[model samples]
Target: MIIEISAGAGSPSEQIRDRVTGLITTGALARGERLPSVRQLAADLQVAPGTVAKAYRSLEADGLVVSRPGSGTRVSDQASSVSPALARAARRLASTGREDGRDLEDVIRVLRAVW
Candidate 1:
């Protein structure tokens, strides 16, 4: 469970939400997998607990995760990852980017331009 925060990306909560969303969509976070508690993630990320909570709430609203009092937050069983073809393409792009010595921001910039 790794989540990196970028100061330039957006608000802390938005960055968390986006990263967690990517993890779930990329199948890095499996369905029914439990997430770190809000406090735990905040502590790990050195952000406010409210930031993590906001991100979790957004994920819940998007149907990517579910939370319960005692059960904590878990990836929603109904949540689905990207299509196989897309995943393969992403992997290829990532590999190519790495080989070309392109950083993540560079790759993302190219992707945005292409989009």
Candidate 2:
């Protein structure tokens, strides 16, 4: 998977995490699709391997991705089970926030307050 991190986005790790999440939610990344290795992705994104690893760890914790010895990481089948409507809404909200020059944390705070 080719992942791009916006220069003005949040931290590298958070940007990676959000990008992967968006890909999964939008069905661009299919269930069980293997993702690039942490080292590979870090090199591609020009970030530290630890940053990519951290993002992968967070995704795994959220049940969006899975990793196994020698198998690398793959999108979890259950990841696609997230409600499409909800995902779309989230993407829209994030886009709106970015357009409004709000950071992700600020958007998250608003979501938390509304939720």
Top candidate, metric TM-score? 1
Which pairs of residues collide in candidate 2? none
lDDT of 2 by residue, 6-77 (tens): 877689999899889888888889899999999999999999999999999999999999999899999997
- Off-target runs (Cα >4 Å) in candidate 2 are 81-115
lDDT of each: 0.95, 0.90
Clashes of each: 0, 0
Query: TM-score per candidate, in order?
Result: 0.77, 0.75
- The segments of candidate 1 whose C-alpha lies over 4 angstroms from its true place after superposition are 83-85, 91-115
Q: Superposing all C-alpha atoms, what RMSD in Å does each candidate have to the true structure?
A: 3.6, 2.7
**Error of model 1, residue 99, in angstroms:** 12
Residue 74 CA error for candidate 2 (Å)? Answer: 0.5
